[model samples]
Every structure is written in C-alpha cells, then in structure tokens.
Target: MTRDEIFKGLNEVFQDVFDDSTLEVEEETTANDVDGWDSFAHITLIVSVEKKFGVKFSMGQVSSMKNVGTMASILLEKLA
Candidate 1:
C-alpha cells in the first residue's frame, strides 16, 4: 500500500484508539504529540495497528519506532 493509504488506515486506528473522531496523525506524530498516549495506550495502539494491518511488529521494531513515519515505513517493508 502507498504511504497515503497506510496513513489513511493509521489515522482511523489512531482516532479509534484515542477516542477522538477528529484526530489526525501525521508522519511526525508521536506519543508526546497525542494526549492519553502513555505506555498502556501505546501497547493498545500497537495491537490495534497490527490487527488493522494484519502484521506483527517485533519488540525491536516496537521499541525502535521513533514516530508514525517509522511505523509506516516498517509496515511498508513488512507488507512488501
């Protein structure tokens, strides 16, 4: 999927996970950028993203992710 496509789905996941229908996430988005995105929420976000995209992220991948852009890149690599 294209980056735009990935972001489209990711946006949906973020909005749902954060319980904010109007939430829009960009490549630079990180936990600090979103309210209520603490550690627990991070785990939930990761699981939700995996389920949404049908992909699993390694612990390294999860820990190393710097931003939504990195996650999108990883998703692209895995999907490819």
Candidate 2:
C-alpha cells in the first residue's frame, strides 16, 4: 500500500488512541511525546493497526517500534 494510504490508517489509530482530533502526527512522533500513551495503550494501538492492515507483529519487532516513522516503515515493509 502507498504511504498515504497507510498513513490514513495511522491517523485513525492516532485519533482513537489519543482521543483528540486536533493532534497532528509527524514522522518524529513517539510514545514519549504523547500524553496518555503507555505500554498498554501501545499494544492496543498495535492491535488496531494490525487489524487495519491485516498484518501480524512478532514480539521482538513490536518491542522495537520506537516512533511513527519506524512504525510506518515497518508496516510498509510488512505490507510489501
């Protein structure tokens, strides 16, 4: 899938996870930068993304996704 298409799903995940429509995401966005983002929430977000994209994540890979850019790249690679 194209990055923009993937990003649309990403944006939905962000909106649902953050509960804020105004929050803008960038490649630099990380869990540390967002309030209310914790390990539990991260898993929920991952599950949502996996559902949206129909992909699965290994524990090691899930443990390694550190930021939005990394997540996007990984998702792209997986979908590719």
Candidate 3:
C-alpha cells in the first residue's frame, strides 16, 4: 500500500485504540501530543501496525520510535 494508505490504516487503529475519532494523526505527530497514549497503547499500536502492514518492527526500532514522523520514515523503509 501507499504511504497515505498506510497512514490511513494507522489512523483507524489509532482512533479505535484511543477511542477518539477527533485525534488526528500526522507524520510529525507524537504520543506526547496525544492524551492516553501510554506504553500499553503503544505496544498495541505497534502490533496493530504490524498486522495492518504485514511487517515486524525490530525491538530496537520499536524502542526508537519516538514520534509519528519517525514511524512513518521507518515504515517507508520497511515497506520499500
């Protein structure tokens, strides 16, 4: 899928997990910017992304995902 499609899928997962449709997700967005996005939700988000994208995030990569832009960049490499 394209980057927009990938981000769209992630947005859906975000809305579902966060239980808030108003939460807009952008490449530069960060967990710190969003309320209720703790570690548990973070893992769930990672798993959901893996399932959606059919890819696995290395443990180091997972630990390094600080913001949505970083994630989008990594996803780009993984999907590429």
Candidate 4:
C-alpha cells in the first residue's frame, strides 16, 4: 500500500486508541504531540496498528520509529 493509504489507516488507529476523533496525524507527529501517549499507550498504539494493518512489528522497528512518517515507511516496506 502507499504511504498515504497507510497514513489514512494509521490515523484511524490513533484516533480510536486515543479516543479522540479529532486527532489529525502527520509525518512529524510524535508522542509529545498528543496527550496520553505514554509508553503504555505507545504499546497499545503499536498493537492496534499491527492488528489493523495485519502486520507484526519487531522490537527494533517499534523502538526505532521517530515519528509517524517513519512508521508509515516501515509499513510500506512490510506491505510491499
């Protein structure tokens, strides 16, 4: 899938996980950009994304991600 498609789906996951429908995610979005995005929430977000996209992320992939863009890039690679 394309990055835009990934972002579209990923945004839905973030909105659902955060319980904020108004949340708009972009490439540079980070945990600090959203409230309640702590370590635990990060894990939840990761799992939710994995399930939503039917993809599993390794520990390194999860930990190395610096922003939504990087995650989307990784997702694109995995989906390819």
* CA-lDDT, candidates in order: 0.96, 0.87, 0.86, 0.95
Q: Return the lDDT, model 3, position 80.
A: 89
Q: How much is 80 displaced in model 3, in angstroms?
A: 1.3
lDDT by residue (1-73, candidate 2, tens digit) is: 8988888789888898889887767788998888888989898999988998899988887988889888998
Candidate 1 lDDT over residue span 1-80, tens digit each? 99999999999999999999999999999899999999999999999999999999999999999999999999999998
Per-candidate total of colliding backbone pairs: 0, 0, 0, 0
Tell me each candidate's TM-score.
0.97, 0.90, 0.88, 0.97
Candidate 1's C-alpha runs over 4 A off are: none
Model 2 clashing residue pairs (backbone): none
- What TM-score would you give candidate 2 relative to the actual structure? 0.90
Better of 2 and 3 by lDDT: 2
- lDDT for model 2 comes to 0.87
Per-residue C-alpha lDDT of model 4 across residues 3-64, encoded as one tens digit per residue: 88999999899999999999989999999999999999999999999999999999999989
- 1 against 3, candidate with superior TM-score: 1
**TM-score for candidate 4:** 0.97
Q: For candidate 1, what is the total of clashing residue pairs?
A: 0
Residue 8's lDDT within candidate 4 is: 94
Give a tens-digit lDDT track for model 3, residues 2-68: 7787788788888888999977799878888889898898999999888877899999999898888
- Which order, best to worst by lDDT? 1, 4, 2, 3
For model 3, give the RMSD to the true fold: 1.2
Candidate RMSDs in Å, in order, are: 0.5, 1.1, 1.2, 0.5
